[model samples]
Target: MIKKAVIPAAGFGTRFLPATKAVPKEMLPIVDKPNLQYIIEEAINSGIEDIIIVTGRNKKAMEDHFDRSVELELLLEKTNKHELLNTVEQISNLVDIHYVRQKEPLGLGHAILCTKKFIGNEPFAVLLPDDIIDNEEPALKQMVNHYNDVQSSILGVKEVPHNDVDKYGIVEIEKSSTSLYPIKGVVEKPAVDVAPSNLAIVGRYILTPEIFDKLENVKPDAKGEIQLTDAIESLRFDQSIYACALEGTRYDVGDKFGFLQATFDFAMKREELHEPLKKYLKEKLEE
Candidate 1:
């Protein structure tokens, strides 16, 4: 069973700029909760017992958010804010979370490699907090279910516009009728004309321990950073990898526009904000 998950949040969040100068991008708020919280909740709901978060400098806030704030809790208790207190306590008790420093801002593949010790010899899940998936079933859970059936590594994939294939790790697949595709290989940010398929690998992954070996041997690209897609493709030569087309809406919250869309969508789902927010948007559109 995949009981452990890794979250590689050591990035500099250069895109978010000045706002991210002091704050970890993963700690940026989406609605009332930090973005990383949503990912952790998904992991916990998906039966993940332990999580190793790969962090870098200025990411201490992310760590503190999950840790217990005793003085704050006591103040909340004294103020008789029972509901707020419960929420705070729940965040702290969510799961068994561990942290490992990546030290340098390598790349996604290197960040994940930092968690090898925590993962030991078992299969594990890797979730990128940038992609917030909204679905009836948690995205990682869906991948886990597929992993159970196939007993192989799984990558959460979704079809993207052919023009957008260059923006993602495109997978070459053996055609199949079901949502699951038998992955032939994966190319990282291939050119539009050269992309094998429009099936783009998303942030959720169920990877085997064997991947660690592949990652270790993967030569850095011209950019001097290891790409996880390269490691996964190398692993494919040894064992099969399958891509499961996840059922849900994926918000690339790492992007500015995508983050705004997620914020608006999540706000519209809240009972207190739904009606008024809907009315306000309608009026703005009519203008």
Candidate 2:
């Protein structure tokens, strides 16, 4: 069984600019909870017990957020805030969380490669926390369950507009069934005319151990960082790779506009924030 998950959280949030100067992007709060927590929760819910978080220099705050807060727990207990206390306590107890420093802002492939010893020849999942997926079933759960059945390296794919295919890694797949497709190959952000299909690879992956060998020899791009797409393409030469079309709305929270959309969408779904947010939106529209 795929019992472990690796989260690559070492990136410098250059997109968010000055705000991210002091904070890790993964630590940014979507509402009340840090974004990384949601990803951890998703992994735990998908039956993944061990989690390896690849972090970097200024990500100490992210670590602290998941650690036990004795002082805060005492204060909440003394105030008789049982619900809030339970919430805070659950953060640390969620899974067997471990941290490894990526040491540099190499790339997603390098961040994942750092966890090789931890993974130790086992199939594992990699989740990019920046992609917040809203679905009836957790996105990773769908992919994990699919992986369990197929026993192959699987990627989470979602159909994108033809024009937008250039913005993501596009998968050339052969449909095996209605929901699953075998990824023959993948092209990272190909030109519109060159893209094989509009099915874009997203942030979730169930990767096999053989990927580490490909990553070790994967050539770096002009930016001198090993791209995960390159390694995956190489891994395709040896093993079967499947792409499962995701049944959910994905928010690329790494982008400002996508972040705002996710915030508004999630907030509107909450009973406490729904009416107020709706009323505020109506007022703004009228103005």
Per-model root-mean-square deviation over C-alphas: 0.9, 1.1
Residue pairs in clash, model 1 = none
Q: Evaluated with lDDT, which candidate comes out highest?
A: 1
Candidate 2 C-alpha lDDT tens digits along 13-90: 999989899999888888777778878888888899999999888889988888999999999999999999999998
Identify the candidate with maximal TM-score.
1
- lDDT (Cα, 0-100) at 195 in candidate 2: 93
Q: What lDDT score belongs to each candidate, Candidate 1 first?
A: 0.94, 0.90
Model 2 scores what on Cα lDDT? 0.90
Per-residue error (Å), model 2, residue 203? 0.3
Instruction: Give the Å error, residue 19, model 1.
Output: 0.7
Candidate 1 lands at a TM-score of 0.98
lDDT of 1 by residue, 65-136 (tens): 999999999999999999999999999999999999998777899999989888999999999999999998
Q: Which residue runs of candidate 2 sit more than 4 Å off their true CA positions? A: none
Worst 10 residues of 1 by lDDT: 103-112
lDDT of 2 at 4: 94
lDDT of 1: 0.94
